[model samples]
Target: MNRKSIAVDMDEVLADTFKKIVKTANDICNLSLSEVDVKGNRIWDFINKEQAKELRKAINTPGFFRDLEVIDSAVFAVKELSKHYDIYIATAAMEAPNSFHDKYEWLMEHFPFLDPRYFIFCGNKKVVHADYLIDDTVSQLDAFTGEGILFKANHNENTVTNHIQVDSWNEVLTLFSSLRVV
Candidate 1:
């Protein structure tokens, strides 16, 4: 029997992008920001207009996406899930065209178990064909046709959502495990 498929997002879901973004924003903007400072809000909303503008350019810079730290246990959890479901890396790379290559390279280095053909780089995630989508963005969840699992991120702490929310990879594993049993 064919296994169900899951489309996993790359940014805040599997990658610690906010951590890198905060560091980049601080280095270039000469500001001291921490997870506490940006909690429950977007970095752009938390910082001043000038800082946001600079951050926008800095993030768009080539190599920004190359060395981002992976989310804790993301590799192990995704690998476990892959045993039961076809895993696909779905990223909104069109927003930053420069991230396409870097993100691909990063995935290749980190998630070598996943086939490169499963990597998706696109603007609208609504086009993704899968049984489930694990993402941190509400818009993407809303667009997805299947079950949406919202991976908790600092910016989405207070987000009101009907979809299931997982605070960590362990939670994600537990949730999927339950789904498999059902």
Candidate 2:
């Protein structure tokens, strides 16, 4: 069977960006916010506009993307998905200049199972060719040519898009494992 190409996003889908942002907010700006409080694509939506500014600035910091806790079940689920698919880490790191190297290194450290050759760092998701694209950003999903899997993220709770929504890695595993496509 020809393997399907699966393009996965890096930030929220795999990197647990919300947790990092919250930590940064609390650590640097002394702002307390929880996962449920992050309700939109913009940082200001969930935080004090001033503190959100700080969080935004923190993201652009060179090493900010390097260390973050891995989301639950993502590593195992992707490992399993890679077995029957050509999995690629398609991250839109260009928008975040400082994140380029940090994101790459982070992936290298956390998801050592994925071959480095499959890592795609770009400004646009539409340029990527894949059978599926799993991302938290709705705009990326809108641009993808193939099926989009909207990975659940606190920032995107109210996002309404024409994509299949998977709340957890278990759902992804079930969806792919039960596939009969050849």
Candidate 3:
């Protein structure tokens, strides 16, 4: 029997990019902006234009993606999911061309169990052909042809959508377990 494929996102889904951004902003601007402050809205909208610009600059800088913490239980969940599905780490790397090397190394370090061949770094996530796509971006989910599972993030806290949503990796594993039975 052929296994169904799952395309998992990198930034907010598997990696704690939002937390890193919050820390970066706090360090650069001496502001005490927490994840709670950015909940239900984009980070760019929560801060001033100058602050946003500075945060954007930090994001664009190389080595920024190198030290991001992996989402809790993400590795174990993905490894468990991989036993039944084809797991692909599909990330929109083109948005930050400077992040490619760091992101690649980060994944290799945290997800050594995953085959490098299954990694996909591209401009458009629509290029990913899989049975399911788990991402934090609503726009990417909207454009996806397969079932889109919204992995909850601070920025997307207030997003109301038709797609299935998972707040944690444990929830993800639970949802996929049911899907796998179908």
Candidate 4:
């Protein structure tokens, strides 16, 4: 059997993007929004369109994605999964000009085991070719050609009804490690 390539998302799947963004919003905008306050996958659900604009602008400021914390066990889990499957980090780098390099550096710092060659920086996730695509954004997963693993996030927890959901990195390890790609 051929080695199945797994396309993993960088934001909520591996990095704690939502928490950081929420924290930033709270700190800079003086808005008190909890994880439970998030109503959808995008930021607009938590704040007004005008405030969301400010948040969107804030994403590119500096050290936004770069300083984001890693999801619990994400590094170890991906490293372990790499032994079983070909892992490719498929992140949408269109969010900001700095996101590409920031995310790249972040990956290098956190997942040193993963080769830079496996990193795919792109816009549309639908174009990504893989056997499995694990992401927090349901729209991206919905557009992907592969089997979508919905990594749960603060914004996406109450959402996502189509794909198989994995709440944590351990869950990801368990599912991927136990299953055989056919």
Candidate that would win on TM-score = 1
* Residue pairs whose backbone atoms clash in candidate 1: none
lDDT of 2 at 41: 57
For model 2, what is the C-alpha lDDT against the true structure? 0.85
Residue 28's C-alpha lDDT in candidate 2?
A: 76
lDDT (10s digit) by residue, model 1, range 98-166: 888899999999999999999999888999999999999999999999999999999999999999999
lDDT by residue (1-182, candidate 3, tens digit) is 89999999999999999898888888877888778877887767767889878888899899999999999999999999999999999999998899999999999999999999999998778888999999999899888889999999988888999999999999999998887865
The candidate scoring highest on lDDT is 1
In angstroms, the error of model 3 at 109 is: 0.5
Give a tens-digit lDDT track for model 4, residues 1-182.
77888999998888988888888788767788776676565556657777777888888776788888888999889988899889999999887767888899999999999999989998889999999999988899989998999998877767837799999999998898678654
Candidate lDDT (C-alpha), each: 0.92, 0.85, 0.91, 0.86
> Which TM-score value belongs to model 2?
0.90
- Candidates sorted by lDDT, best first: 1, 3, 4, 2
What C-alpha RMSD separates each model from the true structure?
1.2, 2.0, 1.3, 1.9
> Local error of candidate 3 at 164, Å?
0.5
Worst 10 residues of 2 by lDDT: 37-46
lDDT of 4: 0.86
Colliding pairs, model 4? none
Report the C-alpha lDDT of model 2 over 81-136, residue by residue, as the tens digit: 98889999999988778898899999999899999999999987999999999999
Error of 1 at 76 (Å): 0.6
What ordering of candidates by TM-score runs from best to worst? 1, 3, 4, 2
TM-score of candidate 3 versus the correct structure, residues matched by position: 0.95
